[model samples]
Target: MAEKSGKAFDFKLFRRLISYTNPYRFTFYFVALSAILLSAFAVLRPLLLQKTIDESFIPKDEKLIVFYISLILGVLLLEVIFQFLFIYFANWLGQEVIRDVRVKLFDHMLGFKKQYYDQSAVGRLVTRAVSDIETIASIFSQGLFMIISDLLKMVVILCFMLYYSWQLTLIVLAVLPFIVFATRVFQKKMKTAFEEVRTQVSNLNSFVQERITGMKIVQLFTREEIEYASFKEINEKHKKGWIKTVWYNSIFFPIAEMSSSITIGLIVWYGGLRAAQGDVITLGVVIAFIELSQMLFRPLRQIADKFNTLQMGMVAANRVFAVLDTHSKINDSGKIELQNIQGNIDFEDVLFSYIEGEEVLKGISFSVNAGETVAIVGATGAGKSTIINLLNRFYEINGGIISIDKKRIDTIDLKSLRSHIAVVLQDVFLFADTIFNNITLNDPTITEDQVVKAAREIGIHDFICSLPGGYHYNVKERGVMLSSGQRQLISFLRAYVSNPGILVLDEATSSVDSHSEQLIQDATDKITEGRTSIVIAHRLATIKNADKIIVMDSGKIVEQGNHNELLEVENGYYKNLYDVQFAEVRDV
Candidate 1:
């Protein structure tokens, strides 16, 4: 990861980000007001010191001293009250900002074309939304709090120092240029370290996540030792990243503290001798200057700390913007609107390629009327799945047209077009929620009764009912809590629940055993009764009842016929596949 240019820290991103909390304006205003009020105490409490020394003590008046002391206590009490308010609001804003960013990020991720997911890793996307956003929020909340308050306090102290003595003010302020120069250097080094930390940490997260996800496979292949050693190396790199961050911070804080202390000691010594030389400055004034000197650099120290935090936050903000800035290569023009879909689909001379000059679907042409079922069968990478993807507009066709009911898909608003399609894949992914939720994920507004009904129609209701919590039973990662057959059944239920005009079942029943497969076949036959359906599978039996069987080879349809007709073609690929299946069955 590259450290952002100095110009990248401009307020544009921050201004845009603050708009996320536009709905919560009152919260923001009150927090800002409270911070300002709390910061005013820096000037007020120190003025009390000046008054006690220059007036109350000079007159030897105990009552006046008591009065000034009481006023200082009151300012302290008010400061504490506003400080509480400031803390509360900043904390609330940080959480809300993080929540808003995550919500928007997830929504955009879903809208992204399939190609994005194919290129991006789940762990990296998660880190962007969770870890990166959280780090930025911390800077906004706690770090920003320290920065604003410290700067305000320093300004007030500087003004008082100038008013009391310009000569002293000039002497004391000379050290500021050195501090600022040092801070700029620290920020530059820390930024580089911060970038290293980000890249290493994310790399570590990706590696660990992948290892965990494939841990069972590793054990099956006896690769545990290799995986463990690789993990240790990545972990060490992450540790080194942190070490660099700590090294910069360690040098920064002590240098800041020692410099401030040395400046204060110099002030006391020089001011002491000046007073002895019978200058117009009083003993009381000298004491007040001493007190003010200590308070002066307190805020400066805070500013120094915030500089490091700001660098880290800036690094995170750049990463987040890079994600939010991504736009899909294909998106609808918002002109096409379909109130209803008849599911008449056509692919007119369609050509597609995920990579340049390597067409996956070469001039594919097909049409299916409403309520017709089409089967696409081919060897692996023969472009059977690619054809379905183009039909659903998951990928923009490199050449030619795809339309539904005579309306071109690209012209139709994507949301309207996609709403009419339901897809069930072999690789099932159920949320870590109840079975009812997983089935009705497409239509969350559906009632529990409707969910159960859909499940029954799909032939999975009875089995689900037998589970410990019925439809409410939890489905863990990839629905590992349920059997493979059960997961497939739930996927079938999900597709059916949408009542889509067109259904795509891609190797949907591959996981089920023979008995459950028979059940699912019966259920799908009923489900696709009046819908345009496309089935892609290696198993010939699954698509036996399809209205049209499309046999593809080398990215082109080589044959098209019904089961009996295809079997009659002695030289056809479908005939060869059927012959192989029968020969294997007879041998077994």
Candidate 2:
């Protein structure tokens, strides 16, 4: 449902879509040749039939009849060969083009800024990248090429028809105006209908994906019936959208068929009349005219449907190109690549917002010296996570000077800047793969032994060894097979293995039990021992011994000091926050 651009049949867009064939131009030209050959081969059988009937049948010449029949059969055999090559290569080319297109689409998506994803639906994107691209394949296989071949065949048939009898050719030409007009009308109706179907498809995909991903919440709240009702409403719209296309097809096809039948009836009636009037029109000529008429009208009829395929492909291309045309990716124009990064982080007068005019981090200033651990303690929505996001260049800042090792972070190559930092987030997401693959992320450089060593350093090696497949244990989607605490351990192990110069823990131990927290605390101590670390924690007790603790409220830094120094301040923000959390622990 992105804003559509251009017409249903955009020549520029069509030209661009065809440009993907540039990589396989040799194959593309070959496919074009096949189409031309197929069309040329098509008209031969009808011409041979005309010759057979005219020369052999009336004379009762068995030898000539057999010769003509054999020639016709030979033409058919060649037609079949070209037909097979055409179908096979056309489809192969379509698949190759889509393969290249899908890869580029996905690569474009990967570079998009996180804000783009925040505003976009995953399912709609999946539909565009996956299903929508599939539709574009038919544009090459069954749409453009087939239409061209059919038209070529029709043109060749018309030439032979005119050669044999101009009067019958004129009769056939008379029916074309009606067919063309009806086709234009059908084409316009189907274009609109197909656009609606594409929109509904995106909506349906988004709804179903979201509901399935959140199915646990639905069942926990006992909203299955409510969700099902909503799904039915979306699904009903999808059905109605398709039914509109079907309705238009029902109306248009029968009209086309009746017209074709009428054209044949006219050919028979008029040819017989010409013969009776002694105009020298033979029986064979009349039959030839009938065959040519069928050839002409059949493509005319099918062209409308083929046109719909082309239209639908164009619609999908429009949606896809919209994404490729987006300019929301984070600018990575920096040339400086970090070498021997010391991890000296600074945020001077940083200002940011997820939404304009509503600042989340207002002129925030902080610093973390090399190999020092700084803890940020704040209430929910205090812009703690937003700071981390900006430092990583995941979101562009409105106004800020963020630097690492005395160099502007934005001037540091984005990849090199991130390669030195590892973050263990509160919500850890794992793929549907083995634990080892998730940890190493299939990096060939990081072997199983290195993963095990990192896990041991984090004190999770023994726990992993207890699983069915140890390091190879399948964690399923989002690590659903592991408990929340276990997943947090896996995340800690993942971070530890990276050997990052700067480590970030965003409420990493917040959801674990006392036993798991003890293990995580040990891992945190081991990991942050010699690295510059930023810890965002809600629990004051967790960071009681940090070198510096910064307290935030709303969007500004309210207090900063060591635990003892801050507690000494009578009404300090950190002192008050510490008291509240301490009292809660005491109450428990």
Candidate 3:
């Protein structure tokens, strides 16, 4: 994790992050321009104070005092107004840069082939999008202003201080090397502290997210206490990291106070003598030195705090940069577009495995004719889903090819390829929105009529109408407001609405009740009427009417024929499995 954050704070990452704000350089300059004028105006106030103390107040000149006081008030008022606009623009620039980076990252994530998501967690991506991006945003907004204003103020004040008295300026300068050294030491420690904090926070976030997602499981197994304890551990780890930062800052502040006071004392004791001994120094010059000390040390305190802030931003950068640096596992050489396609799919001795040396689909070869309804049957873990995954290019085959109408899928553009196919998964996932959005999934061209027609075909439109708000009613996340059967119908509607050339129903009806199953079957027949459909079914009844039923075992096709043909092969693996399911259906 240190390595990860180390990369985040890298100069190159900041340069890239800075480049995003480059487009708004004029606005940044306006802020800087205002700051320069404001700082100039700011430094003049102390000089005005010195004049009032020595010339106006002591000599009892009321008019001069009033004049100086009015000027001071006017400068303060004007600077505040410009400073307001400057800060507003700076904040806007920061947010805009964040928006740009987030947009670019999301677009890139979408371009990454499906395989990348298969290997990564949603939690990490969530952190990158929210927390990590916010870090860079802060650096751009608040950090940039502090950096620019402090630097400019430091340079200007130092120059003025030197012009006043070279001897006194040198004394202030002597304290700086120690101040910078102390800051440098704390900076290294703070960086480690902040990086650890970020890491622990991510872990805690992941843990809480997991528990919330699996709340039912935790309750069912009576592990809520266990999970809570586990969560507390992670959360406390995060707190410890943050506490370390607070502890160090507490120590550093007193040290800063001591150093600053010592410098001021050195001035009062040493510079006072020169004033008393008839040197060129006046009460005004000594007073100016005292005022200058405040300017010098306040920025020094800010400088110390700014280092801590930089470390925090750098910690955030590490995670964000890591994600941006990731290269997608899949890429296309040239664009391939398909206007129309006949749904003839062929698998030529395809070999695939999720894990090395453990082949899931070993040299499995098959062919489906145009408009064929092929039922792929298998016992659990017999590579049925693996086969479905291959057709859609979810995972590339280690050997052989998946071709549609004899055109290789690898050569086809992913968008074009997926556009021709749709799958209804076993775990039906729906958006937390209206039924309209859930069915359409934000496809702009899909009309309301299409949504109704698709839902109607899947036998859920009437059920939706019966709900209080019907289709406009909230769907809730994962369609939790509805039954398992209703969710299945929604998933089915998604598949049918696509009007895809190739349809895959991977346990699509597994969770549906019998009545809903029959309705889904009717809709399935309608949708797959002129297209090829691949059904991965465990239910014996659903696959009975398929044009072909192929039994899979240990990643190889053990038997192939229609349902009756497989039943007739009494001596095969098909016979025993058929007897068990056949008996259960009759019992039901």
Please report the candidate that would top lDDT against the real structure: 2
lDDT of 2 by residue, 57-93 (tens): 9888999999999998898999899888888888999
Off by over 4 Å in 1: 1-3, 6-8, 18-30, 334-340, 442-445
- Return the clash pairs for model 1, or none: none
Whole-model lDDT, model 1: 0.81
Ranked by lDDT, top first: 2, 1, 3
What is the C-alpha local distance difference test score of each model? 0.81, 0.90, 0.81
Q: Output the number of the TM-score-best candidate.
A: 2
Q: Write the per-residue lDDT of candidate 1 for residues 191-262, one digit (tens) a residue.
A: 788888998878888888888888889999999999989989999999999998788778877887777777
Q: State candidate 2's TM-score.
A: 0.98
**Which stretches in model 2 have alpha-carbon errors above 4 Å?**
1-8
Considering TM-score, where higher is better, how would the candidates rank from best to worst? 2, 3, 1
Clashing pairs for model 2 are none
What's each prediction's TM-score?
0.93, 0.98, 0.95
Candidate RMSDs in order: 2.5, 1.3, 2.2
